[model samples]
Target: MKRSNAKIISTTFIILLSIFCFFKSTPVKADSLTAKYSMDIELNGAKKTLAGKENVSVHNSSGADLKELVFHLYPDLYNKRETMPFSYTNTKNVPLTEEEKGDISIEKVLINGEDTKFTEDNEILKINLEKNLKKNDNVNVSIQFSLKIPKGTSRLSYFNDVYSLADWYPVLSIYDLKENRWDETKFYPIGESNYSDVSEYDINIKVPKDFVVVSTGKEKEISSTDNKKVINLTAKNARDFIIMISPYFKCISKEIDGIKVNSYYLSTDDKSLVDIAQSVLDASVNAMKFFSQQFGKYPYDEFDIVESYYEGGAMEYPELIQMPKYVTSIEIQTPSTKRYIDAKPSIIQGAIHELCHQWWYVTVGNNEYKEPFLDESFATFFTAYYFEKCEGQYSPNAVLRSLRYSFSKLAEINPKILNLPCAGSSVDKFGNDKTSYVQAIYVRAPLILEDLRKMVGQDSFLKIMQTYFKEYKFKNSSIEGFLNIIEKQAGSKIRDYIGDEIYSGEYKAENLKPTDEEINQIKHETLKEKIKASEQANGSVLGSLLLRVENGEKAIIVKPSSLTKEEEAFVNSKLKSYFGNSYNKLSIQSDNSVTENELKNSNIVLIGNPWNNKIFSLMANNIPLSINKTRVFAQSFSENSDSVSGIFSAKNPKNDQNIMLAIFWTKDVSTDFYFDTYANPESIMIESQFILSIDNKRIETGKF
Candidate 1:
């Protein structure tokens, strides 16, 4: 009995020692665990076809015991024709999952040392573990799978110049925060994580020989035999992986800070085809050179560019960037029939943007699934920045001009931040809504960062940014964390903006519209009030403000002789509109002409004018008072008038940029024009300033 007790105590001590060791070695993470991975992908001819296998290693960093493993098979699994009764329910952008994900049968699933039941639920394939893993314990799930790339997915990938398939298969899902703990209640809406994702990914692929493959990670090694050649790769702690294979590839290599650029293109019919690569090479070199000078250095070797067919666009892999055929060829026989000659900027732009991903998306990783704006915005900003710095001052403007095609789309919508699922989990809900992931991210994040730059000035802003890059260089962090560092560096300016993010809540507002009722009310109110308040004794101040007409305003009488040539011409030219097609009348009422002395007797108020807000007292001798939350009107006016001031409290005034305001004025007998003055900020506030220059045609605004 004593011996048995001794053995038990010894075993318990050993287990406790192991536990202590683990706790000491684990890195600290918040609300979730940090998982590290090493994946090996190689093309093998053993199956006489391309085969893929994954040896995923995971660590349970949190308090919860992970029970199951879920894999996201994002490929266009099972496509069905548009059917009658179109229920149209696709949760993760995958509507036909059961039928599509049904084909691949998991041949084996082993947890610890035993077999388990791994099932498929639409695009989600999972293994329900036989036993729950304890805290700090690790698990490895080995999966061997083969895919028959489906037809017509808009999905594409290149296989040794012969097969270019995209969206062909369901790659493994990424568990960024919590491992497989997601709510299917809503598809990923947009921005930030609702829960957490935790899982390690290690993929192994085997393709045929005579192919140069561009993929998601740096090349580890190449092992070859007479029958086939294989390349082994290991991408650790990354969100997704892509491998492009082509046999028609011509390899051209260059070195930037020892970071290798392996550009792939088709060996063209002409000998000058060489420059295609040389151009791409130059772009790669110049982009890296410019970016490193501006931001930091490139961290990886073995970047690749290969021939593409789908829209001739480029998708960047970690070490390799893929190129389309025409994108690289130097042949430019015609305007329409062009190659690298026409695609120089895109070739460069795509290369620069993708390469920037090394820092933005890949290095300073954020919740891309949550706030993709965090990623794409930086890319967009940098894309323009690179163009301007590399080419010329105005070059990026042209590049940015193309992006502005969507500005009206942006202006029409309010930014919506919906809690989304883990990356790769919610494939359905993600799309380019005018404020979609890419656009919203591309627009707002940079806007905010640019605002930041303006706020702290360039030098301090760059200092803060440099610190950000150095701190979060290769780790995953939250956007809040970024804001925290900025707040620490720039102080309360950024803090208030960030604190207001959730405080503002989420409002999905449609574009502004001026209703008939609203417009009619403005017209009725203006006529009634002005006819009563005219200090000219001609009935009201607006009476003198008006050009001249009868009580009913059937006609407008203008004193062209009493006005200056500029004023008469302005009045005459502006009068045609109201009298041209409408029932308004004009008369030559010499007394109705506005005079400096008459202004002292009446109160003239122009709706929707900041200048009106500025000199309200000067407006026919009215007391000037300013306050917020006041309702105002905008007017359409005629030409050639002296001036007046407006009275209203602006939220944030532009101190540096001139505060310009526009208003439209229309009189009972005729429409007229006037000018006014508004306050310019004296520089000290960091907020949005609205001049409220009501675009007289269709103006509708409200209090924020």
Candidate 2:
């Protein structure tokens, strides 16, 4: 699932009291125990219900007498608003209407062809065995159940003509023989909480003929009539089965390296939306191809990316993923315009992030409730690797820089947050504070892997991952088990190094900081890339000038030594709004004291009358627009008025290749004509030269 930035209600008091009682359970090897499910369900769209009969065949090979069976009824979490684990305060603290509540009811349960008594409580279903079945014993359990699909946005809900079904079935819970207990972790409101052993599934669904269904496995057979359709799907060695149905879904498919990749989206007549769907399909294909080669091969032959209405970002299943429709449905508002921004970059990043889960959480399973970082942190790190190698939009260095900057800002509010342990932490450890959970698991945990990568070198780190994946495929792994693999591949000292950080979370915060030289290098590379892209598109010079300043290029704002208080205030306010905390980096030099070298080396912003500003006077001939005390002149047009104002960009005479000279001159120095017109410099085109009147009207505009 994509991490949400939304804040959650604090449960610090509850957490502190329960923190000492947390214990780790030892994993039990139950390879001999196999579960195969055959389910037949019918969906009633009007009633928002799914009535199904499930026949499960369980084979016990644990060499121990089985006394009882346990299953997780995840949908029960939504039976009442109080038990739901929504991170947002509105959902967590408020009551949900009856129509917005979801739940599952087991009407009947039969074991070995006999009616059996069962108990259900707190999302757990247990059936006491009538007889102690010896090793190699097999039992067939038949369950009749009905699910009330809620009218809201969630993993299991009906919203906007879409039904997303995840964790909606009575899944046999993983039992630890060593601990002599079932893994009965409740559904968490934030992050993932489902954990199960790999099982085979043969599912049959009957829905309205118009509804299109996308699920975890391949569609093996289909039969439909005039009003209804029944689809048969099969999945082998899958951790869980998920299904999504919508009447308006349209599918586009492509074959990548022998794997058939399908993208299911809401049908739309808009060409732009169709294009976005295609981009999502392409990104999924690219991610699958890249991860297949890097990690182990994707065992499944079919993959699906289904767009649905789910608020929790994107979710991953066995061979399928659920993407939020808003990824392509929303429009963003910028300072200059409200337009549908290109969502391809976001699609790529999000798609890759979920696709990496196939390897971390699906093929190589882990106990998410006990050790979420095992899957989430690895998926995050691998997603970075995919971007760094396949896509340049988010390189590893850039991701690290952004993470460090975000953590530093959070530290500003509470420095102790830096000491929160993440590696061995469980979902319950953080209680209801989803923000802190994300910081520790998603942000800090990945950095620990990155530190290990830097310590052991890239080659050994890759080997360690490949070995871990190969060893733990189709089984649940623990953090200590992963560290043991690391020790086997690398040295014991390397294992201890990571173990200390994981257990104590006491790494030096200074390590997160990038040195000044590294910062400069990043800025230099960014400026070069922006310049190249702008030149390729024949963009405006004004755009390139702003890009240089934003990338940390030296910039100075020159004003006349003599200025009215109003003019000074205007300059200071605009500067403060534009630069925020970084305003100190930009020097406001008086025209009298500005040096010749500064004018030549820096991206100069001359903001006064051309006659009074020395920097503007020096470059008046080289600039595209000619400004005077009462008039502004461009190459094609001239505006002569007391309120005439203009802004333009030109190559610096001394350093044409690297430096830019931009001037914002006005006839009325006290007026904020320039700032008002160029509030969002990025919206301006490159090489732009414009003249405007004080009434906020454009008199003349052209490119240099």
Candidate 3:
């Protein structure tokens, strides 16, 4: 019964979230009209601890009667004396706020230095204003607080030998204009998009001369007076800010496009650490050019790559990113003892991914908490695109990371349930990090874009992306808004596809139309060979795909041309059984341009686009990917090698909940890599010509 209820909730989130993105309209400038924020933080640091206070400036862009100003008290979530709250990303300090001895709360509400209306819900504290000011009226809110770090969670600021303090203080919540959905649930340990009114932050920190700090804003001034270092920082209009302080840290710097690039790491990091940081920056700056030229000029002074203790490989903040320096820490026991040692996945990939977030989340902000895919997918696709651009390679072996992940997740979850907002998904699922971050953010997203690229030319496609970024640069967006952009640029079919498949999890997955080169290759190799091999054969393979209305019973899934009439009849009969209703109704184009619905009728769809003579115009340099493979890759109707996907029936169908897909392929040698997820590779694999299936009862496998 609980399982049934869980399914219902998951579907709700998926549907609502999809409804927001699938059918987007024109972009909006949410930040331009709503508000802007800036900050100045002053810190006092020592050996085992550090403390600071911030002053914020805000402009109320909303016309509504404004009363409560919400401050996202992030660190307070960890102070629970019971189960300690923590994530691999941002910091959450325990005992973060000093409880006021006399009155209501630790925070002294000061609007223009006077008390105002304020309230606290869970950990988020909302401040009230004295006057209901009209739109565009500005105000200042100053917060003075001291924070103490728990030894386990301290990676940002530390006191004695090596105390690092991360996620230490209060930052502002990102407000959504389409709807101000204050997703104050909890910080996703992975990372998330944030909002705060734009302001100027002037911070003065007094730390020991031995300590060094890396932060979000520009370093205004640094001076030492009486053995105490005063480091002042001032940040412009950014969503949020973060600071990292440590005594045992070291720095290596480089310049990209004239912007100062700083890399921070522990002294223990190898010498190559500097080069790796530069590579990440070079790749990032190159990626920035791709986006800036396509989207808009990057809206900041500098971007940072700092070595942090954040779990996973890396995490992106507004202007700064925390990167994992070592693949195997001393804790891994022995590296040589282990045969492969996982090749020690470095911080390089992690840095590239996080820096890419600058465009998707930091600069052109989205509601990441609700629809993580908006950022994750954009970045995932960006990751692939950047790899090809910088490394001068194909979309690397990493594309399968998304393929397997989406496929497995699709089976375990119904798209209906998977679409739920991350906040709601947590209750529907277990933890927020469990499904939403993996599925909605990483898995399903890249495929949507990959499919988009396949449908349209890369030149036309990249133009649409640039327009989307330019339009939605500072505003919160709706699904309708996104649909409008695609509709105006791409054809209406694309808009509908986004609405139905990408948005509703009802994607066709029908093989995309191959280029003329690919179609001719099939014609020359298969049909032409058969014609030469047998004098009696008069028809062309094009005729088979363009098989007239008369031949349509359901679909014509022709395999190796050698077949008996009995086998042909058997295949036709099975195809009709699967697509009986559409069999007789379908027809092909005179030019043999197969439509989506026609392909949908087949038991297996083959969308083989040859890389020959085609140019991918993603980068300024005409980099090419030679994707020439001579093999028949086959999988069941639902069994695709690309992604493990699940189609959840919003309303449980009375029919049997059985879905077993068998993909048959004919190739000389199958590549041995990983599957079962977009990232994790321990699920299951059926070797060349082998079978793979998924159902609630059992996973059946057999070769045809």
Candidate 4:
């Protein structure tokens, strides 16, 4: 009887488990906004024209009924010279030529298989729906349009037999719940203007059979029929799509952790440049791996980096990246900065920059119109992060070094930007000055992120970034979204810190010296002076003299001196930064090797003091001030000069067109007086670590 009871109990338990399994197997619905697009396009490369037919399926997730649909016609903004956002002829920015202009025309629009009325404005396309679509309803719209690709270098253009297509379709705009309408932000030239919803795409492109296509989304298939190549692609949960096509493309690819990375470059005979491009591709693969560990996994199965003709260094899209062909050209040269040399992988810093965008922008989407910094700032920060952590370019103290450089320069050039918060300022805050806007978004914003890291600690900060990526992936995020998640992770209100670093418009700048405007004014005046002095001079060879001191065993002697390795490296870096591409123009020589004729006709740069090189002794009395082994005494100029390390500049006695900059030190001080203040004839005395003494009357102080 006891055995029979045990069997019945076991059967009852099994029946209960079966009931739980049935309910658990039921599917749960996922809540998200959905828009599906199907497109067919024909490329006419010879005429630089594109004809496309699109069918869009839209779902009304907004609670209220929608009577109209809004779209962005981006191609219209690039057609005319008056409406064009930017030009790339030179720094002064030349206007587009006739052949370089572009335009777009809508042939027809259909809603629910019926004719629909639509109006086109500058980058704005609004369609009136005949029927009022209720909430949770679906509607289909068909658009037939044609685009004239311009012969220019921009996001969308055809240049050097390369065609780049960005925002080429009539994409639906996001619904602003608070505004109760679609976002109507117009196109702006300085940054990206399109704000879109995550959508699915099915694209079919037909081009000449010889053309090679590199584009966003997964390649499904390619077939050749009737001397034309037909390519099909599909993408899900993407904010934008871009494509590049060229008949001369030479393709190479590699896979990293299941993610395929393809690099497409124009076929070239220069093996050196080709090797450089390959190395850049390799760097990008490493960037992807580093970003995935820092933030989160990169969701896409493949990433593409294509070399094309664009004015900018590079531009990033969902899964595709466009870079200027010059980056891989044989003529391309890198800046001789310490950061560039130590981190050799950053030779393709542009590629690393765009790869980071794949995670920050494509994966964790943001409204580029409302918050440009959200994408640009993070991309820049990670670029530096790639240098410091991934590429091993930066030393442990490099962050502090970069911070000092960025802050000092920003404070000097435009103190106003220091007042604006990185997270709170709008693109319009910079007004027409694109330089300040770039500095604020790229440089200042990254420093703000670094400050946050310091406040919350490294582990906590990593957790915050990962959490943000997980929560906002495939969705649009705002500054509020970021701060909220960060605060939750830190277990405290960061309002004060956020306000001080990102929102507040107040700053203290007493610690910094030599404003950028002051420095620039001096540079301009000096260049002008050089021009005036050269009006009747023999030739345009305004040269420079380099001198160094090497203490010998027996006695101090004058001889031709070659720089040590460390000295050569530092001088090269400084020369490149100070003179840019024109560094080679400066003539270099030793103190003893310099001819008397050369001294009379060229600018002189003395590396050591009068006590060591003896050349400065000839110009000593002519200088406004003098210093001894113990103290700084003045002949005609006066200021506090105790513990001074003398770096003086004066007019050459023989030629007014020439000048002399003496980097000197007294016997008592060991502080290496290294600075880029050669533009002014003023003497800079470093009394202490950060103290600077500038005699007003000596440099004609107010003139700058």
The best candidate in terms of lDDT:
2
- Best of the two (1, 4) by TM-score: 4
Residues forming the 10-long window of minimal summed lDDT in candidate 1: 678-687
RMSD for all candidates, in order, please: 21.0, 11.9, 20.1, 17.6
lDDT for predicted candidate 3 compared with the true structure: 0.47
Give one digit per residue, the lDDT tens place, for model 4 in 1-704.
00100011133633453333222222222245557887777787656788777777788876778889988888887766545555454333556666877777887787866678999887878899888977888877777778888888888888777889998889998878788888777776666676787888888887777677788888754677655777897888889888788888897899999999988877888886688668878888887888888898889888998888787668899998887774322222335311111222334777888888887788888888668767888887767766767434222223433443556666777778676645557776666567776767776666767767767888988898899999999888988888888778885466356545566555333333335664564344444333323222322212222211111111111222644565555545544543443445556777667677777766665554455555656656765446554555555444454345544434565565555544444533232434442443222111111122232112212100
Ranked by TM-score from best down, the candidates are 2, 4, 3, 1
Using all chains and alpha carbons, the TM-scores for the candidates as numbered come to: 0.55, 0.75, 0.59, 0.67
| Per-residue alpha-carbon lDDT of candidate 2 for residues 1-704, written as tens digits (9 for 90 to 100) | 21112122134722432232111111233345478888877787767888777778887755578898889999999887766655233365567899989999987787866678999889999988999756777777777788999888778888777889999999998778888777888887767887888899888887877778888888844887767778998999899999998887899999988899998888877777778778889988988988887777888989998888776777889999888773443465656544354455666667778888999999998889888989998888778767666645234333544455445556777776777765678888888787778888877777778788888898888899989989988888889989999999998999998888887665544576666765655544544444445454443454455566666888888888887788788767755654444567777789889888887778766677666677667777876677776676666766776666555556666577554545454555435455432343334442233435444555444464
> Model 1 — TM-score against the truth?
0.55
Poorest stretch of ten by lDDT in candidate 3: 645-654
**What C-alpha lDDT do the candidate models reach, one value each?**
0.44, 0.73, 0.47, 0.65
The positional error of residue 233 in candidate 2, measured at the CA in angstroms, is 1.0
Clashes of each: 76, 7, 68, 3
Deviation (Å) of 700 in candidate 3: 33
Models ranked on lDDT: 2, 4, 3, 1
Candidate with maximal TM-score: 2
lDDT by residue (587-682, candidate 3, tens digit) is: 322113443343344422221122211111111031111112332122333332332211110100111121111112222111221122112111
Candidate 1 residue runs with Cα over 4 Å from true position: 1-49, 76-105, 151-205, 220-223, 270-274, 327-341, 397-439, 443-445, 498-704
